[model samples]
Target: MVWNWQQTDWPEFRYDSAALASLEETFLLRAGELFGAFHHVNPNDRDTLRIELISDEALKTSEIEGEILNRDSVQSSLRQQMGLDSETRRILPEERGIAEMMVTLYRTYGDSLTHYGLFSWHKMVMAGHRDIQIVGGYREHDDPMQVVSGPIGREKVHFEAPPSNQIRAEMDAFIEWFNGSAPDGKSPRPALLRSGIAHLYFESIHPFEDGNGRIGRALSEKALAQNLGQPTLIALAYTIERNRKTYYEILERSNKSNEITNWLVYFAETILEAQANTLTRIEFYIAKARLYDRLRGKLNPRQKKALARMFREGVEGFKGGLSAENYIRITGASRATTTRDLQDLVDKGALTRTGERRHTRYWLANTQTDQSPIERRGV
Candidate 1:
């Protein structure tokens, strides 16, 4: 079966720009919203936002590859790379690798994509591995790089990358296209279009032996960031990982030919969804900042500790939702104190409770995604 790169017109992707124009416009509009919200984030707080969002994308990107790195380790590594932390501490190789790549991507996204830059990213991704015929360089193995699944006898090949000898030329052209197709390049494209195409193009080549998906996603993130003139806050990998099965299906389908309008639409919608999710996170942070202001000196030490712990879990609000036992565990309070603290939290609007008696669960009350308090007042 012919793949996209095997086509006579391989890599000359075709799509209806009109079909994606609306999505492109909406993307810009939402980006404006995000920029405005982020603008209000206190400079110090924006650093925290950067660390959290970048760490989340790093974690989710790795999760997509079926490799789960410790989230705390990822964040800690990011803190160090981003210069937010300076206390030298031991970090696992696996954790430090992706964090370093992400931090580097965020810092140098505007720089042109080159062989050395990509090699650097590949080495960062395959940090601790002792195996693999090639780590930071293109695969020179004789066996075809086939993506497959199923048991030994019934293995089904999902896709196979171009042969090793073809990689250098393919990557050279891809890097050229990536740089030349940017928003301000000689052949400029819209934000989402450039990002979507870059991702599809890079994935079709599957240039590296491993971490191609992660690096491809990173390339797309760079593409998006280049358009906006800043590092993107959108959780592209996190959003894609939610519907991973469908993501693979669409990608597989798109790889068969270069007329990739469907793929572009799918990817743009994913970016839009990611953008919204990011906005919610920013608004949640805004709400957290406001809540802290509201709660100053109003709560006991236990409540303060509990609230801080809950907020640490971010907008998701402590896994499985916060419970009285959870609060007690967090604050080391007795049953009576736990009940009182929970009730007091609910009363003060710091948290909202659901269920009753033994089943009671709580979440930060102000984290309404529909609107932030500042927005609701029409500020």
Candidate 2:
């Protein structure tokens, strides 16, 4: 099947901008409100949000390509690269490379998408790998660059990119299109539209021997961030990873034509979903800090320790909710003391207990609270 890259109107994408109004509205609604709420988030928590977004993007983008990175190492590598707390621990090479690429994307969102920039990103993404024939540059081998699946003799060719001989020229055109379509460029497109097209355009070229998917996602993030005037910090890759099957399906279909309304709508919806989830996470952080402030100096040491453990599980707030037995395991308190401390935490507005008797389970109070301004604004 012929791809868009081989069409007569190649690189001259066409779509009805009017159709994106609903998506653009939702996009604006979430982005405008969420960022305003960000101003109210504590500086420390905001840093946490930034790290989580970057590290999560790094990890999920890799996982989409079947590379499972160590979450702890990825986070640590991100913190170190971001210069947070001057993190000095050794980072595994896989984690370090993706973390570096993510941080570069975050820091350089406003910069022009250049060949050098892409090459640097490619080098970082390909770090720790010794066998790639074209590290840090476009593939030079004459072999076809094909996206395929299944066994050696029974493979399915999903899509094939442009010839390797044409990569440099294709990439030059892609870079020009990318920068020229920017918010500040000659023909500025809407944020989601530009982002969607940018990602599609980059992926169709598939310039690198490895790491094209990761870099394409980065370009999309940069496009969003550049238009919005800050790093979006949305769980874009995370959301896409969860819907990876649909992502590939839509991408494959969109590759067949330049009329990409379906692709844009799908991507826009994905962005909106990602932004909403990010808002929930941010609200949780704000509520968490506020709860900590409210409970300060009011809890016994065991209660404080136990509550902290519960919160360490993040927005989901401990698996299956925290149980008294779980509390005893965490705090080493007697069953009697664990029961009392858990009860006291509930009474002090520090937790919300659900179930009863042997079925009893508890949750961090902030998760249940309807009081956070962040949550209120998020709606």
Which prediction has the highest lDDT against the true structure?
Answer: 1
- Candidate 2 lDDT, 50-70, residue by residue in tens: 887677788899999999998
Worst 10 residues of 2 by lDDT: 370-379
Model 2 scores a C-alpha lDDT of 0.85
Question: What does the lDDT read for residue 97 in candidate 2?
Answer: 92
Q: Any residue pairs clashing in model 1, and if so which?
A: none
Number of the top-ranking candidate, with TM-score as the measure: 1
lDDT of each: 0.88, 0.85
Error of 2 at 168 (Å): 0.9
The sequence of per-residue lDDT tens digits that candidate 1 reaches over residues 100-133 is 9999999998998899999999999999987787
